[model samples]
Target chain A: MTEKLRIVQMGLGPIGNKVTQYLAERPNLEIVGAIDTDPAKVGQDVGVLAGLAPLGVIVTADIDAALGGGRADVVVLTTASSMAKVHDQLLRILPYGVSVVSSCEELSYPWQTQPELAASIDRAAKKSNAAVLATGVNPGFLMDFLPAAMTGVCRKVRKVTVERIQDATFRRIPFQKKIGAGLTVEEFYKKVEEGVLRHVGLTESMHLIAARLGWQLDKTEDIITPIIAERRVTTDSMVIEAGNVLGVQQLGRGIMGGEEVISLVFRAAIGEPGARDRIVIDGEPAIDSCINGGVNGDVATCAILVNAIPVVAKARPGLRTMADIEPITCW
Target chain B: MTEKLRIVQMGLGPIGNKVTQYLAERPNLEIVGAIDTDPAKVGQDVGVLAGLAPLGVIVTADIDAALGGGRADVVVLTTASSMAKVHDQLLRILPYGVSVVSSCEELSYPWQTQPELAASIDRAAKKSNAAVLATGVNPGFLMDFLPAAMTGVCRKVRKVTVERIQDATFRRIPFQKKIGAGLTVEEFYKKVEEGVLRHVGLTESMHLIAARLGWQLDKTEDIITPIIAERRVTTDSMVIEAGNVLGVQQLGRGIMGGEEVISLVFRAAIGEPGARDRIVIDGEPAIDSCINGGVNGDVATCAILVNAIPVVAKARPGLRTMADIEPITCW
Candidate 1:
């Protein structure tokens, strides 16, 4: 595996940059090329685009040409949720038998909800005789890995809850817009009515959890809050309006029997941020796990993806979300 | 369509009594009998048991006799969340073709999260040639009905969010316990860890919305906060302990896509109780609707339910939750 694992990076954004930084340290991994929709960075080096100075590798808007370079082995995805739109690019490269590992949050919770995309990715990957693995640190590990860790002491393990509260303004601009900051109550209400301004990523967090538990989530409910701080507050340097906020807190749960639910709680805030999470299990070997920063949701997610690379590479050639990947002993 | 609908009132909890009171005033409905788990209530008048004085109806725990009496056409359920146990009574009579309406919160969201329970109810109802309609004025109607009603104005419905807040101590004690009042942070942690203390009805709330739009939900999550008054906070002649909370605020959400979520936010707090809701959509048509209340949530819930009765009775039923029922014309 150390024979230079040539990688292709897509979606020139924050997490994409982080992925590049982490993979740069790996002796076996080599980023062969990169692609993005932004015209400003098209002819620049991948490292320069990632803000880590310049690497010899050039960025290209032409996805086909990037794949046509023919040096790439695996496509490392950081594309947005609609990464599904890159299906044609995925197909073109998969025929060349290039496997994939992406930062697409949707991959963690793929099977039960995103059946269409999962099926498409699988079909394309199999046709090319390569595997596709998707993941991230938040929905990938923070929501999933920690809960999976709790099962060690839990015997009947009924439910697990994960909460993530982050300042979206500091992480990315799109997220700030996604949370609808600066919008009046009426404007926020309008977006929820149309279903457009709703924040993304957490759904996959819940999906990762349910799939890890091997259940089809019989029922689920949520509340996306665009709360107006009755008392004005600020996070970092952003002065969030006293009555308007982009902060979002949501809950996702899976019920198994009668009224017993396997639950997960998620909250992401742009203005005032405090992070916390807890998970409980019942009936024999009842267990509870709590963490202030939510059990390494960040660094561990990167690890999860890197670790999965080996497992996915050896698996059957097809599109595989975290669910399709069998559990491997990290030890 | 009423023809003096004969109904059996089962359970005499706070919610049960409210339904009984509602039934008392409706000239088109007749309370044939009442059932309680407590033997002390047996042979007592329902009005007395319901705190409304004698109304000529006897309260009995004989579930079999109530179904066998053949005097009622529908079973108004107000039992615990364990409907599998309470549903037995409905099934015994279901074979005789009697319909049901209940405050069984999970029933509204069961098909997605609790398919087993939903399927069983559907099967029993089908065998009996009857219908099962489960609702709550708050969890069912307020959380589900209002958002669905506004969907008419949404062009591409991306997300839906609902928030409900009420003072439970002023409303009911069980709700306070259910929300984790009168406990330390450790105790609250214990309950949430055991999968017993978190919000129960939000999953149904998500299912209600999903069923309405024919959207498949992959994730549902929750966040529960135990509210306690500390150091001589006086409210209406009550001095509460620092850790002895009176209610809880729970937020639950469901994500349809990575960025699109249908969220339900609920609060049952005696400490500081008020509700303000706002929704955000990315489409052309959007909205903002909110209600402030000095009374218990049940008061508003009852109104929401009464408004939806016509919609439920007229609609086709296969395990109907609020979202399955047509939008309430006015609330």
Candidate 2:
């Protein structure tokens, strides 16, 4: 909107790579730099890394340099949701009063889930008088905006529930490992004991929704057990043994005032076939929407962040979470 | 299991009264005592309050005597979810090592949403070597159990959404007031400001869900506004002003990892007709269930609580939420 905005893209992961591709053609947007921990590819041409045309952009871990020297106008982070590291990178640009948009789950329930990290980000954002916005597809768009938008069709609501099912064999490799793709039940239990193997994004989505909606989600719970395929299967190049590879299934439920209001479920594996999502509303003029596959989740989330840059840029600067405002429209 | 389990029913509200009636003639359960805040009904017989045969159970607000001096084995709390003070009552019954279950939303998210209260109650329960469980119809049965059971059907999944809607004019009074039924847009906003009116519940549901499912919901938001009637209508007792006295529609969404996994929405109002709820899953073996609202969710939550006592009573300690234990049979 203002003479071709400069932006920094973080992480060279699948979504990050996809984001670069999406942003490549936008005349008003320019990639000043890129960040990733892939040591082998550091200092490599980001355009080639993102599978796009030559843009002269290089992937580097030098977040500070990317923030300063007028390297970029805004920082677009698509890193891990725990991205407390993003907070540090965000600070370097904040003092310059630069705006930041991220696909970080940490920003949603920053206080309750990550209080210290959230407080630090908040302090830095306020001190620099720069704007910060966190959003993404699953945690950003559908969880927060789709439901809010659905209220338009109903007259009265007694309860609301959200259900999502995903098959991640089509997703990138890292996601497969992250969700425990080739693990036995015994190994899965071991990982659970160590508290490291599991899905990572949906929890933040719930936080964003609750804060905006003003319902007190008093209790939440999830049951995670790896789902190994009943039959042997193989992926693009990998052979998933009959019971060696995980046919993962994860389901989480939430209760408010002793009543269950929401459920978050995900399943991913190497040989899984397809994916689907559905929503049902129980009011006058009841509504239901069921769709197939991932359906622009992360892409939509990227759009939400890019579109909301203007809104955050206009609003007051501070450590703002979903609780501080509504599931606003970027338009 | 133990001679019709002497059960003490608390808060003789509409829900409490209905649950008492629902279980009135059951041979395995007995109403031993009752509690309420109303002074007028303080000494009245519980059976007479529900217009049933006299069981000689008297209602009182004195929680101490109600559970102290070796009284009932378990206390069924159906008090208002807004009463944070009542949660403290949950801790008192435990010193006698008396197991307790409540329909309190506060107890559901006591640790995350209301940590201080959850901690204090946790300490109280620890001192008493007792266990506590909370649940209800929507947040309890449908949101928590139905989805958990649906896990058996899916081999792989990507996202999930749940929905519930009910007409409030057909519902009881407390629900209408709490959901801000029959109000204009300006009036609804005013109530949200007053903190006296709210959609109630979903927040805790989302919170518990994220924690239990092992995904980190870093950001969440709610989309709620006013729902005016499209046309003029009249209810059994209340007059409609065309666009007034209809009800409010609400939605809450939770997303994880840049993908929308859980989408929850519902409708509820009294001025209209009947109430209904449904669950729709999106996996290879998808699920769909629509239930009529005859279960009386308010009281059914209490039933959910009482029903869970069997499993929770035997569960390990240290702040165990719903997913921590196996699903107990209440049907």
Candidate 3:
């Protein structure tokens, strides 16, 4: 019998729970360890924490103990949003020689934003002979990878634009709150200036597309603005009055030689008319594609993380970006 | 300095000419030889044949001379529409240790139609340590590869359907004539029965999708029907009277355990309201995607061939299908 690939779940948040639940059902993948810092979750059954039947494996906070057995081949890390917050944790895990697939938005293309930390991670991964990749739906796949793949049909690509719109009212409470769904416009601007409200990774996506196209971008910009509610909007946990901020409208652009070569627009708001993901490539024989209903973020993020495990395991050992790896597939 | 990848272009048909034109402009790719059977094109400049300025390389009809010098690393073959017609050509090239990327539609997944020939090609490729791949925009990318890639976002895929519609009036005269654009309905049916008309790769696309998803199909079917012209239509050289055939509507389906798991529909006619490509997956969190303004076949086929040259060169030695190779990318 062939040995199943062993996977360690390193976080127990909503997305992490989704990943664990999905991975538990795959016959070829075995969940070997579960780790989290929360006191309540540290001693719970991993399966139960994932809202599934108990699989007999217990969650623990000890990273070294979980990895010391050498049974774990890959770690699905969803503990943080930024690479800075997860840098030390990666340092702790890479030495075990286990590959990692994380959901860190900033880590998706860290070389563009955190060059020093990206190099450090690369060095550590190389020392351990383990490959590392960061990916998610918005920043990694839909807005970046998909656009780059579409350009495969073009003989000469002059411009690429991607637009993603989602109705946040159907999302979870944390996601709703992250978008400042019930805040006043004044407060929304305050949070935006405080660097706590805007969406992350738009600029990272821009840089990624530019690099894939071999364009040396002279300028890259990301701007965020509030999407105000036109009428009363209510979700299961929150209510937004008219004139209050509904969500965010963010745009990122990469300029090269005075031309906007890459552009990404993301909108997550309440009561949007017709949510979809669209990409337009301008060149010889232009292309325009749209997904009538955009991909579900929570589910897609987990699916990509799980699907990427086998890919990362086969990748070259080091810190890798999506562009550096093979085109992602069902395997 | 790194050595450029050497490429040999075979068959200077409409698509082959486009491939040569695109490959000539790439800095990382160098055109080493061009081959065509036409007496008029045998000694002409390859660039002029491609409607471009002179590229110093002349067209040749000598296959041995092209491969004997070891200057060619890959051959882009666009000679025929079926593997049976191109099998000997592939055998000749593979033994030279030069990888091949062909546009033969039936070769896309020959295990379904020509298993014997497929295995022979595989053995030849393995013995020579050379890889062989057959790909085009329709069978290789838009229908099979793209749909398979979209499933990476799903935890479970129950059914997959792809719809591609093209406006044939924009295509070249040969393509327009191939679709029986000026033929009557009776003539179209006769041509279809005679195997002179209809799309070639829908069944291949179905098999490719099934292989990727690991589904054992119990039954597969391909159906063809004429799209009657609603009104009089005229192209650059021909005209179709009202009540005549506009083009062909082809459908292919794969069934497993009495359930239709894979479905493909393609429509290319003289006049259509909208020309786009759409895919729908019925599974957890269903997905609907549409490419508004479908991919241009001529341009995309050339782009895919040129882009796949490097991939085929680096692939495992065998008769590899699109599903067997790494995810198709711009590289």
Candidate 4:
């Protein structure tokens, strides 16, 4: 008989619930606890909240109550995209000697942008002998880890470019709204100014690639633009006329030696006919790779978080990134 | 200033020479010693043999002279395809507390085929506190590691298939000849009977995928067939007429519960117009990935071996597979 890994599901959001459902399907994994700050979800059964039959694990707002029992080997954290918001939760979990696999975007590679906080987390994890990681489909795997792994087949790498073009029609309603689908051009600009229309983690992905390739960059830059629907575009819940905004195009560049050596382009719109994920490497033995249809973001996010559990459990104590551990696989 | 990692180049074959060239290009890597059993290569400067400026390191025939100096941090070994042939060399190198990254095919996942010998090597590595790995373009990356990494994006995986189609026209003369590019069907059958016509790593790659996916395969089968030329095909060294053998097609299958769940198809021939590397995963979120041009086997073999030095140098002591350490990246 195989031993089941005990894990706590943090943040009972869509991604968290999906991860719970996946854990339920695996006989080698057991969900022992759940956490959420929402008052209404505090006392609900975790499995029931995830749309599965009750597993008898209750959700709690108290982190200590969920993790302090010493039964949790790992925590699946899907709270927020920013490190500033998730830092406190990580600090509380580390001292319990529980490893964490988070979906926090900025925490994916926070060394450059949040060096002090990263070091602090590293210190806490080391003190308690726990491991911490942040990963997802885009920033964690597609743009950073995938390109870095492809470079293993090249003798010399001059430049690397990755593009993610997604069709947002079948995505969750929240995701469709998050990409600024069916907005006027003027409104799109206003939302960009408010910092709500753009995607996070492009810059983090750039830095992760640079760190793995041993490149010292002069600076990193991100540019966001609106992709307007030229014709009538209809989605699951909305309709946009010609010249209206459909989604956003985000580009991130890492400039080194006065040249952009790493470029990541993300385009998400409602009616993208040729949705795909592509990577191009310019060097000796050049590589041109493509995924015909882009990876499903919400589903993949849940999968990567679950897949990282075993890897994180045995990792050396510290703040770890996707590049710091072995390539994640479904187990 | 960053301290350089000292590496000893062993084997002095085509792949070894290419690895030496790549190592010379990196400022963070230094060639400390070179070893070869060939009389013609012994005493020759490794860099000159690799078609580069002389690096002032002479190739020696004795392994002790190359690794016994205690200056080598790792060894780029490109000696043989079988673990049985390289087991002694590994035993000799591990006791020096020096890590090894070989191009041996069977060593990629030897636990299934050579369990007792693999145990011996593992024990030696642990006793000496050194890490040992075997990797290349086929068994190590494209068929095994690449697909396994892609599965990180899947919620559930039902089947996996990888195909490598190569055009032998631009390859080295030796590789063209080895694929039996200009042989009759009868000659090809004779070579197959002698165990010289089929690719060596299909079964190893199958086991690697099975291990990563946590699948218990009942058995695996490899089938080899000649790809006969329908039209005249010409290469730099030879020409083949219609009805003659142009190359080979090799298929490897992994059966689980009496069903074929893993399939790898490798086809290499002259005048192959659509040469590419592709992977298809059948599951909840289907992934159809393709590399427009197949990864050049020889060059990639060299690149992966050299790129693994720094990673192997810092890994924990044991017999490691591609799944055991962080993914290899050019640094």
TM-scores, all candidates, are 0.47, 0.49, 0.93, 0.98
lDDT (10s digit) by residue, model 1, range A46-106: 8976678677888898778888757887777777655566565566668767788766666
The global C-alpha lDDT for each of the candidates, from Candidate 1 onward, is 0.62, 0.62, 0.86, 0.90
Residues A67-166, candidate 4, lDDT per residue (tens digit)? Answer: 9869999999999987988888899988899999999999999999899999999999899999999999977999999999999888889999999999
Report the number of the highest-lDDT candidate. 4
Q: Provide the TM-score of the second chain in candidate 4.
A: 0.97
lDDT of 3 by residue, A68-120 (tens): 97989999999998788888999999999999999999999988789999999
TM-score of the first chain in candidate 1 relative to the native first chain: 0.83
* Sliding window of 10 residues with minimal summed lDDT for model 4 chain B: B1-10
Against the true structure, candidate 3 reaches a TM-score of 0.93
Which of the numbered candidates is closest to the native, going by highest DockQ?
Answer: 4
TM-score, candidate 1, chain B alone: 0.85
Better of 1 and 4 by lDDT: 4
TM-score of chain B of 2: 0.85
Residue range B23-76, candidate 4, lDDT tens digits: 999899999999999999999999999999999999999888788869898888
Q: When superposed on Cα atoms, how far off is each prediction in RMSD?
A: 18.0, 16.3, 2.6, 1.3
Q: Residues A185-230, candidate 2, lDDT per residue (tens digit)?
A: 7777788778687655566655555543445689667677787767
Q: Candidate 1, what DockQ?
A: 0.01
In candidate 3, the residue pairs with backbone N, CA or C atoms under 3 Å apart (3 or more residues apart, or in different chains) clash, namely: none
In candidate 4, the residue pairs with backbone N, CA or C atoms under 3 Å apart (3 or more residues apart, or in different chains) clash, namely: none
Error of 2 at B22 (Å): 3.7
**Which candidate comes out best when scored by TM-score?**
4
Tell me the spans in candidate 2 whose CA falls farther than 4 Å from its real position.
A1-331, B152-157, B173-178, B255-260, B270-276, B282-299
**Model 3, span B63-115: residue lDDT tens:** 88878878999999999997887898988887789999999999998898899
